[model samples]
Target: MTARCSMRLEERSARHIDFTGREDRPVQIHLRDIKRTPGPPNPAGLDHDMSPPPRLQQVPTSPLLSAFSAHRSETLSAGRALFVEGDSGSDIHLLESGLIALSHIQPNGKRMIASFVVGNGVFSLSHDGMRLLTAEALQECRLRRVHRVELSHLPADQAEAVKAALDREPWDIQAETLMHLHKDADEGISYFLVRLAGRLNGPISRGSRVRLDMSRVDIADHLGLTVETVCRGLKRLRSDRVIDAAGPHNVIILEPDQLKRRAGLGPDFD
Candidate 1:
């Protein structure tokens, strides 16, 4: 792409999106800035983003946000880093929709997948005294972010309210991923897909299709697996008669119950 951006972090307090080739005004943008390039139906790389980043649209408007005058929004492309660990924590996103892989990059450059946050998940939440981790888009993602100043003003109960919204998703299989420092590629990949199917749609639908919104490579990167292994897991599930590839991005579930059993959930969860 034609849009040139140097790597630097700047603060913003504006009402409009930072589009129109402006210098950094809390606006939204594509991952690589390929403006003229024509995108495809699924545009393998094209983001399924809103026009000017996602608006502050999630329900239960954050009382914390009341302290801030402006907000920043952006759409993240799959596989792109949202924020690397150790970077100064500034803002947090109110994810509209999509799979977000939170992983860690080692000094040796090896990566370890941590968690795949979906739906109304918040990316920055410190609990029991732990710092932030890395976050990246596992698929075309739309997000609205508010600055830390806003967080600082969160009323005790209101702040707790926002935190409660993020918690409650039961920390079982996926929560165990936080401690991983090294990559377990294979097992990690399996756990990720299981969580994805478990998170977005319910488990495999007895005799229906399941759509995989994120790509294999993003899945691999998020799960610490090679692309090949991610594909293998999908094939393995199909072989077991648990699921079927319905189309490029869809999978049919022959036995949703079986898939739930693997994801640490009961068949009667509904």
Candidate 2:
């Protein structure tokens, strides 16, 4: 590039010297108009001669996940793939609102969703995307994707948590924490619901039946259970008067203590 710069300067200098030698009468050469050769290419080192016209780059955005910068942020409609398996990881994503389904597509094109992350969900965040899964927004949503290279350094606690979450599938999260006297999708779903109820309200009481914040399909995906199984499990609970469905997104706890017992008793819990 420096060689190219020097040649350009030489060409311009030769032209300036021959100014009066033209066929026209003597013309005042505005000496000020002779621009000095630009100092060693500006820090960007871009070749001015061959560079393409610059487009309006999307805003210099920041990642909601943390301090990282994002190059793109937009509202994605349902069924949009944020990332695909085996693809190189260039960015980490954060779903500020709405839900996203994470799935693994089998060789036969069957999709087995591992989880459905809702508002404040994070994705594609491993150092190299070791746990590869395809993320698709299940509903209209807003997302932010930041270049991984730009976020090499992060604070201690957040960095550790995000890294661990990236290394393992979402199922591993509940599996590691919940003791399974009879570990299975059924029991996992029970535990998940009971916990969610407690989180949203309090310990199971007369009105303690948990109302799922997500849909039945979302719950099934998170627990590795089939949709039918999830529905049956909920129905079983309902028959036992543990809960009553107020509507699609609403449920009333009928027997909180019994529901907790059905989840299996623990001395620590008692």
Candidate 3:
């Protein structure tokens, strides 16, 4: 299943979905910025964090992208939907830059965040042909969309590049499943923070402060916990000197090794 995103207080119905957002001009970035980074063959971290100040990597550039000339990039303002549930699945997106949240709304009106997408990640509608989740920008973002029709005609190597990108989606679902097995909310929260920290390394090292781009509510939804529970978990971590919530959105991982243990991550994952 493809992960998607949503964050709104409005009463939502499948019949009516909105894409309203704050005023922000479309940003244009060159295709050279659309690099490909390999995701772990197995789900390596907790909920995949896509926060800024990224952990830059060296991965092969998708030569397939050079073949396309007609597609144009578009800017997605913060809180805007790149595509809503039930929208046409005409294209799959390549996140050029910035963070995006993937979420799903249950029939009872509760929302569950699927995962987060950082730069170079790919997201699309559900595979069955209609959009199944809502993908919303957590911050101002720019992305390139390749039409599904265009994808079908690509040569083998180019097609493989796209497939490799899409392979990361299943790993997220698996990670989410693994998180729930522990049954401890604090452990789950630790797992979540550790994953975010892994992606957004600090200037000096991985132990530095990590800026959380998503809100407490988003974290709660992704972990299947309540906002209050999420708050308490952070508070507990703070009390133990495991982490420091420096501000509403900034967190400093005081003990990286201990944090991994709390998340049930072994030395191999570390």
Candidate 4:
């Protein structure tokens, strides 16, 4: 017997139903033909309700970023490759502005987006001396490239700052792995938005929006879901009033607690 599932977008939510079939072959359902209802209009004066969260206010800049502020920077145009997978890891790339995507290509040639490193972030951290994934600019990016050996030559205080930043890398990697393993598509998307909002240097409050530089396809790749699934998930969120979209790339979180609930995160999570 073959097992099959059918998913339909309800007026207020999305649900899937499973069924058993007598056929000996697996069943595949195509979702390409499904249509999403247009989202509601943005309410007038919605921006006034949004405020920057308290944590975003008065946060100090990273000492590591300050230590390297005087260094010469490099720029890459959108869609340019920063480094290739399996390349020798020679430099740590610090993002000054714009978005960078870290991705891995499987042996089957499928490219999976692992994460996005926004400004004030560092990438290419590995214990082994080789790149495990490729890095590319999602937009025109400004970056500071520091060779590994150069860190040891820095002033003691500056070097310590860099070390402290590097120490947190493992925690981030572990958290990302856990998020992927634990959440379904809907929860994952909500968690991604919350994390992205927290990373932004500016203020984010209820009704405050985050601009997503990546496309829906890119988001799906990062979350390990199909494009259709991401779209359906977003639609459900919007319909439930947990979030709203100003446009395709910008998401305004309407209800932070509700969004966090959808993400399966605790209330204390920023």
lDDT of 3 by residue, 11-73 (tens): 222111111212234332111011123343221111222444336733335664542323455
Off by over 4 Å in 2: 1-73, 125-131, 153-186, 195-218, 221-225, 265-270
C-alpha root-mean-square deviation, candidate 4: 15.4
Report residue 132 deviation for candidate 1 (angstroms): 3.3
124-161: candidate 1 lDDT, tens digit per residue: 64333343665666556867666545554666865665
lDDT tens string, model 4, 127-166? 6788776676667787876777888887788778877777
Spell out the clash pairs found in candidate 4. Answer: none
TM-score of model number 3: 0.69
**Most TM-score-accurate candidate:** 4
lDDT per residue for candidate 2 within 1-270, as digits (tens), equals: 453221111111111111112233332211111112344533212122343424863332332355432224456655445554554564666676666666666666445555566665567723355537656555557776555654556656545655655566455644534454265655675676676666456565666544454545456555657656777777777777777877555667786666666666552352
By summed lDDT, which 10 consecutive residues of candidate 4 come out lowest?
A: 40-49
Which ten-residue region of model 2 has the weakest summed lDDT? 6-15
Q: What is the lDDT of residue 147 in candidate 2?
A: 54
Model 1 worst lDDT run, 10 consecutive residues: 14-23
Candidates' TM-scores?
Answer: 0.60, 0.57, 0.69, 0.74
- C-alpha lDDT score of every prediction, in listed order: 0.53, 0.52, 0.63, 0.67
